[model samples]
Target: MSVSGHLATITSAEENAFIFDSVANGNNAWFGLSDAETEGTFTWVTGELLDYTNWFTGEPNNDAILGEDFGEFKADGFWNDLPSAAKASYLVEYSTSVPTPPGIMLLMIALTCLILQRKRIIFKTE
Candidate 1:
């Protein structure tokens, strides 16, 4: 499915954390949140319920006169609503995969090797 189709499913804190960490690296980026159809009722582009939101303090104020209907992740990892025409990078979420850190992968490999070695030693003694 497209990112818009899956964006509403970002219901977990881990998913939110990953998105914030990935997109908020000293730069602002757009996401799927929007209220283009009806102000104050933010929804995903795919029409899914925007059940998970991390808006910054005093945000989603719809304070712009031209209509601020799109959501963006600021450089500080806070969320803010912006005009759709605003030029900024956007974030697209894929439901099929979760990004794993290199350090975690290395630790898993090391643990696996240690367990296999211990098994081999036990078998030899028996």
Candidate 2:
């Protein structure tokens, strides 16, 4: 997975294991075959196709012109089910889990340096 132009490619079994755990427990359904039970039509979070026919009766009937249109993906070109255009959230799961970004490591390194530097200051003050 990537964030703010940084990429973290998941290329290991341990990482995939974590992704599976996250998706299994996460509230948002971002990965794996839909429990509705079908194969080969595996819908991706990044994909535009939503199975409207499988929607619950009266579902996916969202109005197109009302500006609250989230179900118009079946007929209208409007963005559906995704958050607003300005949002930068990531879908962290699929059939397998994705990777956390490298920036988190950088942040940890910076925090560690700051903490160690504080220790140096205390030593000098004492």
Candidate 3:
């Protein structure tokens, strides 16, 4: 499934696990990019080579307990490829412009205002 241009790849099999990060970096709405690979080479639509690999232990083994043949992938908080007999879904994110939304903008502004208010109050009392 394609969500906002971020494609979510999943198996129709009920045992397959979904590969995506809906809450990426603590944000609920985020885009996850999953690329298909063969022979240790990835072919992502983004055109950037994915070299970030820190999968959970015992993961990406491609165990055929449910089924197999789809392939495998993993990121810090996401993983893919499971039993073809199991069902799965993909939740993806995409950006309309070249730059993505600054998720921390509001937080930064809030902190700045908080600091300023504190300083003003302290100086007033002094």
Count of backbone clashes, every candidate in sequence: 0, 1, 8
Q: Which ten contiguous residues of candidate 2 have the minimum total lDDT?
A: 70-79
Q: Could you give candidate 3's per-residue lDDT for residues 5-111 as a string of tens digits? A: 55432332221223333333322221233222452343444555555543347645555454433333433443444444544343443645544347777778889
- Poorest stretch of ten by lDDT in candidate 1: 1-10
Better of 1 and 2 by TM-score: 1
Which candidate achieves the best lDDT against the true structure? 1
lDDT of each: 0.76, 0.37, 0.44
Candidate 3 residue-wise lDDT at 19: 32
Candidate 1: tens digits of C-alpha lDDT, residues 1-126: 223233333455676687667655777888878788887888777766667778899998896686899888777777889987789887776555457889999999999999999999999999
Q: Which candidate, 2 or 3, would have the higher lDDT against the true structure?
A: 3
lDDT of 1 at 120: 100
Judge candidate 3 at residue 121 and give its lDDT. Answer: 100
* Residue pairs with clashing backbones, model 3: 13-85, 13-86, 13-87, 14-85, 14-86, 14-87, 15-86, 31-93
Clashing pairs in 1: none
lDDT of 2: 0.37
